[model samples]
Target chain A: MAGGGNLVVTVSPHIKSPETTGSIMRLVLLGLLPATLWACVLFGISGIAVIAISVITALFCEVTWHNLRDGKGTGRTWFALVSSLVVPIGVSAAGLGRAAPAAAIALMSAFILSEAGISRQGERRHSFDGSAAVTGLLLALVLPPLVPWWIPFVGAFIAIWLGKEIFGGLGYNVFNPALVARAILVLSWPAHLTAGWFRSLGIDATSKATPLMLAKTGAAADLTAYYAPLLLNNPGGCIGEVSAFLLLVGGAMLLWKRVITWEIPVTYLGAMAVASVLMGVDPVFHLLAGGAVLGAVFMATDYVTSPVSSRGKIVFGIMCGAITMLLRVYSKAPEGVTSAILFMNMVTPLIDRSTMPRPFGVVRAGRGVRK
Target chain B: MRVRLIDLTRGLVQENPLLRLMIGLCSALAVSVKVENTIFMGLAVIFVLTLSNIVISAIRPVTPDNIRIPIFLVVVSSFVTIVDLVLKAYFPEVYARLGVWIPLIVVNCIILGRAEAFAYRNGILASTLDGLGMGAGYTLVLIVMGIVRELLGTGSITMMGVTLISLGTGFQAPTFMITFPGAFLTFGLIMGALNKAQSALAERAARRATGSAGRPTPVGGV
Candidate 1:
């Protein structure tokens, strides 16, 4: 069972299995579920709302851009996209109920056009194909739980459009779309993105900095007591930063399923740990604070953006961790997981090119395998 | 004096210096954060460009080909200095905001490019019009970018020390739009939208052409 993609042809030594992009993406969603569920449980209704808006917007953007780019008879669909985008920019906290109808109509029409088979001759239906879903969910996971409704909507648009589609969609995207969106959001509306951190089970929200931020204050002797709460419960950061334990569990599941390799996660965390010691910060605190675990496990190991060869993956991870530590120690920004991962994403191509393994039976430059 | 309309109109859209020709972008991007800065910058560029074009065209007959680039620089820089002095004297606020970009206009590709490409071969009248048109095109794009960036970046458009448009007190403008990367994003999106529109127009024209030819098209059978 080589999955549903039976007709795919490769260069040579085609190893076929029951794995498609959909299946891998499915595995990724499962991997992320633990942290996401924990985040939702911690943040409550606001967290669920943020996730819903982001995922729906992500789907809307994916479907809208896909149909506009590839679908036939797309005049009406084009109108739908413009109206949906224009209408939502006005969606404030007091006006969510008003924007709901417009969003619903636009989404429903797009869903019908894509799924209900208004197929025009040779035009094939575009699948939702969990890739966009993963990006949306990952974007939600990285967002602060107490964000305004429009923040996730805008983030998802940026993720799908500027981050992914503009780079020629999916595997062709150079950076992880979720991280790209998060970085831009952090830059665009720093006040909105940085503030509004919620606590678990409806405790005090807003103005509470993440553990990474607190570490910047240098409570050198008082840090150890916070590790237990930071590990299992939420302190104050992005939604997914709630439980390092659950995120690690999900990461381990992915590792066991071979969805993600050990090189990136292991090297990324290890490098951060070692570098933290070098920088005179507590290594365990560095490892556990902010998005280090989530970023190392999920963001850095993105298949499209990460390097291919084993050596390249190691280089990528080590550099990511090093950059994260450097930014955390010296930079004005509290955490640097997003920036570090994006920086490594930009460097991934160079790493892949440098570390590409030679063909079988080929010794050095002078020796020939065929001869 | 041969005055061709194409010489004046072409730069407006068909060959916008910033968007289509992709020249004079350094100053364009750098000074495009606010609407007022763009207006003054556009004026400075237009004044220098027109005068430089006229001078370069007038000197073309006597100016030797080998030394013409140096000659162009001299003429362009002379005009740029005039603009710099005038802005410094009259519009100190805009000048202070524009800062180094005003002086940097001496090396602006639009002015030098018009001198070398159009004015050197054309008459003064044509060169003058070309310069104005190109400058207008540059101004148009700069203003559009300025308005977009300023409106989104600051949540309002303030011109001439007066508030023109405000998004309201609740609006938290994205500070990113005023940053360096935002200029690039605005430029790219504008260009992309223009490209998409042009492609759509071309496609429709092709479809119309086929339909008018009365051939039994593929769609006709379907």
Candidate 2:
């Protein structure tokens, strides 16, 4: 056998980094494990069931989509499966409701079928990468537990087809697919999607109004009761939302592994903190009670959606935080993170274009146009 | 007389106000949500476009070139007022559904655009044909968009309270298809498809013209 026939091809920017796409994805999966495990401990068998169903459905969808689109099946199906499972499982573990499992399955199936159906009869089959599953999972995590299952399916379809495929697929998308799905779902079903709040384990679980909701309706509730539990990781919310501590830990791990940068999450959370302080609201409560931490760190800071440069990421984060706070306090809805992220996603191209790093030893010209 | 027919037919494809010129998009996007609203708006536009064009063309010779813009506005506004009043008095239901958009037609760029571009230069007969063609084109686009949006948004198509098509039991509208963003996406997609079709047709025509000349081929002389 000729050695040249079996030779592997590689390209530069050949300066090697330790990370591979699979490694980065695996790190993200690892970062999510703590919150997922915590959710399981709190929510019990329903949580486990949802995770199983979501993962299975996501994998099935990915395989089916790949087979239909590419006319041949390949590897990476398992990764897609796991990524999809994470969202519904995360939501269910946070106590979305009994419908979580069924909804996840339906959405996964529909997303796969629709994507497959839309492709031409004899195009090269698209890869069954883990991206769609990851998007579905992230969207599930941000959504309220009480959302009708069909909503996620629509979100997944929009996120995958419109947000991702319309711009070409996966890495080409300017925004996070998960955040896109979550935004559409929230906007479409504000009443059902934003209402429910399930408490954490060993906490006095009650159907009390969320702090953001209370702020919106001008109906004040006892602040200490809500604030303390949330700070200590005991507040009621979506699966990953209950534990600010765990999310931070995961975020830190992501930063340490160089899986994500410090600019977006740091600026976003800092802005939220500053804004909360300036508004004279409990800063701790604002950070802990809603999807702010999870969104800022995990969803908004998605590599595809967030800004490319360090400074751009910082500006993007601050904008997201400020908008999230404003919407939470002044708008009709309880959560604003998803919308803020999606809105920021739309402007990412502009941000990247304006803030591209200057070439080495080059003199800059006059001020550029503003978006 | 022959030139007038070309001017009239141009609006059907070459100068389609909605797809080609991208004029009057606000009402086009908003009212295209329902087949009924689209039809109503389309007919209203036709009436307004024709009347405004004829009136503008009749007064074109006397109207000063410097003040033509304002004079065109006045003509368009008067026609819009007439439409608004008539609709309010007779078709109260459509009047209510159309709401402020009917009055907004006075300022619609399509009306003003035609008044300045075509009606001001052409004779009354030519202007009338141009107006009719443009109105017909606008109506066709609106109806197509309305059918698409209504069918997708509600999972059914209804015209004047009669259901033309339904997706059957357990089928519900996406709801977003009727909202603002949906309107943008739908308009964008339709515009894109229109552009694609137009280009493809042009390419085919160019290819046939080029192929015949370059090859020195005789048709039916094989």
Candidate 3:
């Protein structure tokens, strides 16, 4: 106001989009609902229980942290109160005994309260938006059904705090929070993450090797058993990732909603199929097994962590697929979807930078100079 | 006397050599994997820092300005050698674990930086207090990092053939906490916490001084 002198401005296309982060996040959650419901039905109450605990913990942590940091109350306190009431039911549903989940919740609550002392206003417009819930659900989907329920609680905390908050939350994160949490959990407790795949529900459900694990050992009979089950979501693998058909349906919804473009999912699966065939592995099995479908459609397409342009997205996909196939075939781990997407997440900015489109009606400086 | 007391207390928090000044980080990050190793490392740093500061400050008047760096190095290296040999003789296991780090302390920036910045200009008493303060601060950080890394990485704390705590047999410790990247992450988080606490304290002090009638604000509080 003191020195109002020149008022020079430029540029014409100044229309703003109507979409807010909360709205987009809501769409993502809606798109994920189909596959999530299928996973719950297939895995039974235990599956729903896993998802419920994760979503509740994530929302509670986000709201509590934001409230304490900014000294303001959140609407989601009601949600936390409700979650606390349901903790017993959820724990019982998941077949976990009284001690572990309770202990984890107690520890997590203490940690959140302590951290809230230094909490500044976080980057999100509101705390209880659907992003944290989306992250929670995605992380749970990638986990084995019989994993200690506390693993989800711990993973949600780490995913929200270390992965998102420390990086200034939501839009600023470099890696997908769910993938980051899963990667850390996998590295930290390899035994729990890789083992304990439940084949079904109730007394009939058995702890069996995942199809990817059996395929890793080159067992033809085991591979044959995987043919229909892998696609139909009847196999013993990570909770939500076994349902390739359902995931595809969910991915189609995301594409129809315009929440995600087809560039990433198509290129990723295409590259994966080509690579798997070249590596002498069954392409269909590679596409359907492990977390490949879940990650390529859901994780790799994360707007905050993936490239912005279509070209960059394609490159990001190819790189993700190539590294995933490489790790699956050559590395000791039977699945590499999480690490591959996380690895590509780290490179998204670089791809975007290199693939930035030139402005319209602008002459190249070097050419102009020559002329 | 008051000023000298401040010098002694400053390094404990205000000018912490590890978290605040961020000097000698190589040793802090590398050797803070075990509580036992941290204890040995801390003791070694204290012995070397205090003695080196005394020797440097006592000789500062007679020492030529043109070659103060060489004189400082000589003093530091002498103390480091004594620590090295004494550890090798008495605590061979720790000595072996510490290995090159014992000798590497001679080049630690905290030692050389203090000699040039504080000891070279200050009196012997002030220099000695600064060294003690800095050494205490460094030791405190090393011990804290050691505890965090050891507990999380191994699921238990064992020192000098004794177990202080254990997470039981069923607990699967995150081995990443003891790795190199884990060290960096731990150090960064600790540093951020220290910064936040210091700033918060400063802000409270400022608020009090501004609100009240006759209180003097803390020196360099902001």
> Top TM-score: which candidate number?
1
Ranking by lDDT: 1, 3, 2
lDDT of each candidate versus the true structure: 0.85, 0.74, 0.82
The superposed Cα distance between candidate 1 and the true structure at residue A55, in angstroms, equals 1.3
| Model 2 CA deviation exceeding 4 Å by range | A1-12, A16-22, A44-126, A196-202, A214-220, A227-235, A366-371, B3-6, B123-126, B151-169, B195-222
- Number of clashing residue pairs in every model? 0, 6, 0
List RMSD in Å for every model shown.
Answer: 5.1, 7.7, 6.9
Q: How well is candidate 2 docked (DockQ)?
A: 0.32
DockQ of each: 0.67, 0.32, 0.55
Q: Against the true structure, what is each candidate's TM-score?
A: 0.87, 0.80, 0.80
CAPRI-style class, candidate 3: medium
Q: Which rank order by TM-score, best down to worst? A: 1, 3, 2
Model 2 clash pairs are: A69-A125, A70-A125, A87-A137, A96-A145, A198-A236, A199-A236
Candidate 2 local lDDT, B1-222, one digit each (tens): 445577688788778898888899899998988899888899999999999999999997799999999988888888889888998999899889989899999889999999889999988988898999999889999898888889988899987789999976555466777888878878777776676576666666767878845533222100
TM-score of 1: 0.87
| Model 2, residue A240: C-alpha shift (Å) | 3.1
| Candidate 3: Cα lDDT at B92 | 93
Better of 2 and 3 by DockQ: 3
Specify the highest-lDDT model's number: 1
Q: C-alpha displacement of A241 in model 3, angstroms?
A: 1.3
Compared with the true structure, what per-residue lDDT tens digits does model 2 show for residues A111-207?
5554455356765334355665666566556655444554555566666666676565667887687666665555556565666555546465455
